[model samples]
Target: MNALSQTHSQGVVMTQAYLEIRDLVKSYDGKQQAVRGISLDIRKGEFVSFLGPSGSGKTTTLMMVAGFEMPTSGSILLGGREIAPVPAHKRNIGMVFQNYALFPHMTALENVGFPLRMRKTPAAEIARRAAEALDMVGLAAFGGRHPREMSGGQQQRVALARALVFGPDVLLLDEPLGALDKNLREQMQVEIKRIHRELGITTIYVTHDQSEAMTMSDRIAVFSQGVVEQFAPPLDIYQRPTTRFVGSFIGDSNFLDVTRQNDGLVAQGIGALNIAAPSQAGKFHGLVRPEAIGLWTGGDEQGHCVLSFLIEGLVHYGDSVLLIGSAAGLNLRARLPSVQASHLHEGDTIRIAWRENDMHLIPVQ
Candidate 1:
């Protein structure tokens, strides 16, 4: 059992993780590491996303799991068995790439059944299973259609059906919807989630899109410079991020440098803040999400900090408005509902307030 499977502080014995990645590292040149020491423990039937920007090792790590790239060091255990030495074809792992990787010449049914045919399955069973797979992805009628005849979304569904026809032990998706338009990409996300729910397959998704990861995954591993910075559920990662990078990368944010001043904390250039201080009482970075700040309309300001915000810019997004400006030498951004900010304009000074509980503190690194 891995360390994560041990009994918790509450004396509950945790179940063993289905897949365990330990100290996985990859480097093209021995001197320069592309993937630094990375580790993750994923439970069975869990959808986990490796989220990061370009050259951040999210894709490299996914390739390592798919057996497309060899790791210079570390172990990948699936169902408690080591698979690092296993070849790509022998690992029984299915992968879908960003480009869809469909065979243009083959019909949809033929493409979906290709994996089974490679295994020398009976012709009759292959046809039946292929049809079932196509139907599962809502493409049974498109069986006779070739890749060129189908839309981008339809082609992606065919690729998904093909990957699952073989019933691989694990499924890895590397930005499968990256090529589609915004609306179609969102449609595919729902389709992928529905398919995952039906199969109960342990899946790993790699994407640089923050919203995609937030919407799809049961848990997310935020990757930066080849290292796993924070791995947690979506709400925890958003509301109580362990690091400043996780906060800034995941969404729009305003970071304030704060120092402990005797009994309370004082933000640089903003004077004393009323938010609760951390246990250590040292220099910290205070994160206040834009949506947390609201327009103050002269009421009891209990447990809230108020500021006079000079509106330098206003962005209208139909449902909401974003105000960008400085307050007492500190630049901040506040997002409010369009109805509340209907009369507001750029260059207007307004009173804005945020709840004390909404501020998250991170240790300065």
Candidate 2:
């Protein structure tokens, strides 16, 4: 389902759409469509993310919204007005590309004030607004420095300042932090979120990074093969995904083919499951997150599924340990706290259990 349909189906009472994309489609070749009929209603000041792997139509959709690419079919409405005919610059939409895109010779202040100057704002006002914009991105003291003189993160801050100085109606960020190192990228994520909260501007961010989208967006649209697989809040997307693709895409997951038999659910390889049956009694793809499974100590197995896990591989992430193993002829991945898995090693057999309610059921497609 599209974003709007999914939201309405869930009984979510949303405010009027400030940015409406109705059946937006983009085709590079006359016969091959890059973006399918995708529709979404974004509320005013809401921060949404278009998330997917490379060439999944997320960027294409963002470009259409930015007026960089015209849609092959359907309409784009910004604040209840059609913006398809509007040129990119005249749309009053601020955009920050993957590359910082700051002028090498221009000072940070000059770069930030470029948009204002293009609009023919007075010199004094441009200078004041540029300084304020740099200050907002925590680059006030670096205004005199050129892009070449700054770090990747600082250059990114300048780009952000440039986008915000004009006070555009909406902001579109296309992987602005992709060039930064891990530590810097994380720092910029926090900074961007703080600025979003401060400005309260309607924003759409496009990224292939799942963690970035999960932590940054108010809602996320998961794109796949030119279509949105799912669009929802971060927690909902992770814990209760509507499709198997969404369940596997957002986080670490294990899928089990299950079917109803004699008033109970049974997995294909494993026997009868203790989990609650879904409302629909039919074939399903049972989604179990790795974190939901725990080491089975001596206790009641009521309302839980216990298995003997044979460890095949182990990966340590300092705080946690990921165990890749097989159980009941099914390959599974289980993540445990480092402290709990201290003695565990490859080729070891251990007891693992997961609560019945922790498993989410997705209809087979």
Clashing pairs in 1: none
| Candidate 1 lDDT tens digits, 290-315 | 99999998888887778999999999
Worst 10 residues of 2 by lDDT: 3-12
| Cα error of candidate 1 at position 33, Å | 0.9
Against the true structure, candidate 2 reaches a TM-score of 0.94
What is the lDDT of every predicted structure here? 0.88, 0.88
Per-residue CA lDDT of candidate 2, range 1-365, in tens? 32212322232223233799999989988898999999998888889999999989999999999999999999999878899989999998889998988888899999999998999999998998888888888887998999889998899989988987876778899988898899999999999998877666789999999999999999999999999998899999999999888999888999988998878899866678886777774999988999999899968888888999999999999999999999998999999999999999999999998987888889887
Off by over 4 Å in 2: 1-17
